[model samples]
Target: MTTVNRSARGRKSLAALVCGALAAGGLAAAGVTTSLAPGAANASSHREAPLISGQPQYDNTDVYAFVSPDKPDTTTIVANWLPFEEPAGGPNFYRFAKDARYDIHIDSDGDAQGDLLYRWTFKDHVRNGDTFLHNTGPVTSLDDPDLNITQTYDIELLRLRNQHVISTTKIADDVPVAPSNVGKASMPDYAKLREQAIRQLPDGSTAFAGQADDPFFLDLRVFDLLYGGDLSEVGRDTLKGYNVNTIALQVPSDHIRQSVGQPVIGIWSTTHRRNASGHWTQVSRLGMPLVNEVVVPLNAKDRFNASSPWNDADFLPFVTKPELPKLIEAIYKIDAPQEPRNDLVSVFLTGVKDLNQPPNVRPAEALRLNTAIPPASEPKRLGVLDGDNAGFPNGRRLTDDVIDISLQVVEGELLGQKNDLGDAVNANDQPFGDAFPYVALPASGSNGPLAQGQGGGNRSQLEGGSAELTASAGDNGTLVTTSLVAAGAGIVLVGLGLAWWRMRRRDGAVL
Candidate 1:
């Protein structure tokens, strides 16, 4: 009894500290800025943490949940992994880690603990290991014999109450995974392959697992001395050509909600990889975008990944008093929101009341969505900030401009200080699909120049072998294509960078 009381008191104190940090100030308190300050931002959890960055196959890069637009009665949850995958990366193309358990968790009763979970376990196969090619010929279908490598997955649905598993059911099995978009020659009709991969489960839900263009767009050059040292290099989409392994599920709205009375639900995704001792250890976790990237400090990053939201109290200090805004204040010389930022708490931990917050909500990091809300007729990229409640902070959508919205909110936009802070990059490089599995098609390998050494080029050759790398014509004068790997080798050429890379590589699991 005393312990419960003490815990309650501690929570109240923390809430008070956060709520009182930002006094209700008007436009006057927020100094007028003639020109909006350029903000520093990165891809939503793409290579965000130290440990997960090294294990891309098990990295939960981004998660999106929104009421399906076409099928308004259903909701879609899209989670991505293996960030920064080169489209032409063959010889050993990327696939979901067979030894990892990729899971999507849902909290229906606002307990900060998942009441339901969908688990995916993969099995990789090689039809012809004798050859080095991903595919021997044009891959017209998912089961084409020419495809040397393939993967199939099974899905299990687990129902939990108070963190104790009540039941576990196998929802899907032997679902073919959509192969990577190797190129035109290998996968001449990739769309048909993706369509074939989509499966209708025993439950009234749709599932798809495959490669897709990374939907989250932002200038990663912010790490380049905060954008070329003066914020000048901001508009280029750093992840333009990259792809990610995606797991997209669309389920009936009523399936995930606690009850008709309780419409809001929290969603997050995690990746657990089997260690050497045959123990499944969680290595990556993601809920809200940028929480791991900008909010959590460097020291507790790995710990945060292994933690569940029910125990988020240990991470309260990071959310209450974040470090990104302080760095923004220091570098850009712009006043940041006051300490113990309750506004952020409202956004990240607890859902905004009268908006997406569930009943008796517990403060934790998860993407809260009001299942009752319908899709917007014309979705606004700024989301709720732009008066579109059907978007982010209400369960993110594919087209939500989270970078600009996060920047503005971090700069005190919600606290009545209207600011237009942004990173200049507006939208994704590729267009998203209009239906289920809304992410864009993965970029093809035949689109650009081959990687440095792959194209018969070397530093020893004069003029960097530009002559050998020229475009060629195939049979009947048809243009032959190759992919360009924009390998930024300059960063590794520096002495300090080399040391940092070696240290980070040694710190995490190499595979």
Candidate 2:
């Protein structure tokens, strides 16, 4: 049966730090655990937003941008959705919404707003419905007839200025999402099918969508650590057996870069759903994993998701006097940075000064990357903090240990305070695959390594297929549909987009 670790140190200045109950102030002082977030192990943004918590498939989980290790001339930007997936998710498997719009925004010139938008829309197909199983027989390939649940998506890459679409082009179309890894017996050659899912776009870009091993690793026992627990107990990776839906893109380095002289670019992902007006509206978004989960107060989490980087300055109070640091000080007794943490503001809000920062840009939040910085030869997990400028906060690499790095920063290491902080679980359960879509293959639902004493059949693998996430979004049970899309995601966006394309073609306009 398929399943997954269920399982750090320090002391510091509480006197100078704000230690009282800080709910009114939106501060998550550690001792105040009532509404404080315990944080996921990977520093992931799973179900972090309030309204977004109500929508998982569209809930942006994590965003990673890096210079592709093998292809240094291209950059890989991966956006994940749906989380905590069990391998044995049968009956109805997890997937992207065929009608809803998913996006990856890049601020190339930086004023804290989008200069480029990569819009994704999916269309699914169901081959058979007589049986309760997703596959009638062993799945041999991505387009196999035995594969009942299949999906294809279109990527509309647009160049934007001042919040209006200036140029739009569908770079990729009909790209298939990889099939679920059911079991070895059912899918003997899973690697080949994964290869099939990785396709080349007309514009010399590469696209991949489907399940992959959850790349972020963290020792989640930090919940216990808040109460003074020993760091030794923090070695287990709680997210070990889970899988998530991923949309990975590899674009030529020059094409992805925005400004002329500046090599740095800011990136983030957002998901939009069709509302009553039949127009897609932003529902969820994420950049820094632990930001909304830790920094944004519980009340404003959803609003934060809906807002843009331009208006991020409105949330400055939360950043400068962050609640997460207060909690670390109150509970863990660690000395957090003093008010006005320019370091954090630089790292999270704006791009790091002179490194990834774009001049004249607003103080907006995004994961910035300096494309000129090549991938490190022997990468360091601690990233820039460890003298490896090629890793996270520069542009996240799969191997970067963001948890430990963030832990060190919040613990006042940036201020010259010393601490031997580490979660102990230094690596992913399975090392990353050395390929275009670097994420590991999706875990099989059947034949999980069922270690002793771990059994519970009630768990559903289609985790976000619930009223909160997909209530109006439409639900497709075991039944199959002839329509390219199944549920509440209206095709109005597709209709308008296609209409625009046809108009362009008819007018003989230069694309």
Candidate 3:
């Protein structure tokens, strides 16, 4: 069937699962579960590593982990930054944080301790010019051109082997840079410009720093409304018409891991800055767990973002905790006729392991992969859920259908049992490159509203109609039109009552 239909089918199956679960318990007679997850009740509505939530511009949105298809023993790590950078935001242009320190940590042993670290930092150069054209403008002679706002960054590689400090390199204009999204003729071979930014390390490892298309696709509006809002339609409504800033690094397997037998590694990224107090503050942190805090629970989300592999002991209990099933039970207001059945804890949680066999670590939130598992040259988008063990939770790639996979696993699809929910997942286009500097989405004109290109065209034809939702801006800047607050005074009253109730509870009164 078509990709759009497939995705729709997946959503219907998930909704069915919720309905079936509620029906079985007679909970459908009460109410639907629509309350927002406590963790999503923060200012920076998007997920970012804990410390970096304060800095929305540079908050690391997602970290991707995958084994390089071309090379064995090599891992590809991608960290995305500056969510929703409008192409029209001109003049100063987007740049990596200068004072911010970025890093990736690796752990060879399953205990989750870093055995190697890769770090990067940036320096800014502000030169004066006649007209400060941020992204696009007319080109002219540079005999005495102003050089205001030029920047360079440096990278460092540290090996825990013998506690040794290994390689260092500086990246500047000498390195190839991706051209801004002007016209193809004006920015002819922009991809080629991006290629220049890839540098070879002293250890022969490859690293790239530049902009690329955002790989994340989700119907975020549906999710926002799904959690305690008036709007109630659900189908995939992801950002099909936008892009994001990206910094990606690829390293040789041996360079990152010792000859030691274990193939597992602990990974995390950080952005740092010196506050007015002069102490360096870590703005963000992310590793193999992959948006665990954001998807898991609120009380644990911040701690998940702030802690490291070495200090995971402080947060492991929260990471491994099975709260969803309990939350589901509570929200559905179902009391067990006999004893409670926390199905989530029994099956999914207990099944996750660090290694393939004996002495396996209990299931946890981190994405665990066995390097010994050869990479699949031709990856199927269905991923591990399709019984193809090489995809997601094994180290996610952009093409993996995580939503469906998560749904299936949560609905007992992995236990060789048929879920009344049917197939709970689907994927969109399964196209991606197979080499270093993977292909990115093509640029579009920012002079008007962003368009979805061919993807939208195909979707429109398949739906046999056109989508009415469009983009709009509120006091908080650009937001989707569907995100506009619902009209009516009833919602206002409920909101005020909630506020007072919260205040009363904070004052230690029983509600």
Candidate 4:
């Protein structure tokens, strides 16, 4: 009887530790997570590695999968690339790298190896390269002659066994890609262009490739010493105005599932680039948010991106003994979870038992989803933690609040801590789409924050009736004073520089 009591207490204590560790880890790491806006929550996978961070075009920022809410018989996978796109960026706006292969891999049987692969390869075209303009005029349609820069992509489905390709089938070709949301001036009806890009594939699937507002929302300020070093700067959405290039596909459930009996499937996305030697190299890999960003050590971050799920054992140590929790403990004075964090292994690697886990599941880092589980009518941001089984960690939905859910779970919600730890960023800046290709429309370049000294159209004219330049009676005097101050500062700087040079010369230092 005493042994049983002690065992129960130990479990409870361990749960508390795990909860605290998770919260601390989240607060200390990349400090970003899922969105909580109505519809689907955006999951983060942005610039998690040094090598991939340098190559935005080939970076796989986020991957989302869920049973299509409208079409319950199918599953949709949305993968985003090129993080933090400035909407105002023009002429050379973002697009998928033509030289790279963007692939979505599925482990249908839970062997930690992908049994099916959906690959997208893009090709760019410029109707008139001589023009610096992205569009000659308003792009009435995707094929508008005014649209100078355009892109098309092909989709190929490959069946794999034992990591070797067994069969390849072309499902789509020459499909028009949804161009960037250049602005209201260029794309008069951007949503119409996006819808037009949504093609009905020969394989009875739906495909779209184009720019979308970055769905992931979180307070990235946690990196500033866990939020202004005192948690004051907590609620702002750091990615509110950014954009990402998205590739979405909604396919019949039966197409990718192993069998009706094994309904659970694991999904992940990777980007491979062709080197100068023409050898393809996997540069970015994403399955779950915050894995590469915080879980893996810096030295192994690049390696993790290039690795496959089947070989995830090499990274087991990081999950078992995460460094984030320890850092959190040191700073927050919270107890870190004990080593051998099997709870995390189950959540991050293998799917949780009886929820999304496959029978005899092999531990691996892939987002697992049970297609058999119908979509939730009214989804909760907290996901399964809130008893909403259809949400993230089941397979990410654009609306599942992964950041809060993950932080709460790590804070011990699963083990019964009942904590509500989160980054306080509840929803995305924009609402997600209700139908297929459910991400929010990309933010327009013309609609972003105004530049310094720029005035809005509605700004009242100055006293001189000129909004462009505000004239003042003291303008000449002000200019003279500013110039004198500048000249005085420059003279002072020059004098300091000459004195420093003389000192250096006296010390026989190099010039």
The candidate, 1 or 3, that scores higher on lDDT is 1
Q: Please list the C-alpha lDDT of all candidates, in the order they appear.
A: 0.78, 0.72, 0.48, 0.77
Candidate 4 residues lying further than 4 Å off, grouped into runs, are 1-43, 449-511
Per residue, candidate 2 scores C-alpha lDDT tens digits across 438-496 of 99887776534221112332122222333332111125343223232443245777788
TM-score each candidate.
Answer: 0.81, 0.79, 0.66, 0.81
Order of candidate numbers by lDDT, starting with the best? 1, 4, 2, 3
Error of 2 at 407 (Å): 1.1
Which should have the higher TM-score, number 2 or number 3? 2
Clash counts per candidate, in order, are 3, 7, 19, 8
Location of the lowest summed lDDT over 10 successive residues in candidate 2: 1-10
Give the TM-score (vs. native) of candidate 2: 0.79
The local distance difference test score of model 4 is 0.77
Q: Write the residue-wise lDDT of candidate 3 on 391-502 in tens digits.
A: 7656667777555455444434545544332122244322456677563643433321233322221111112234444433444445443442343356887999999999
Clashing pairs in 2: 1-448, 2-448, 8-231, 30-327, 87-445, 88-445, 473-488
Candidate 3: worst-modelled 10 consecutive residues by lDDT? 1-10
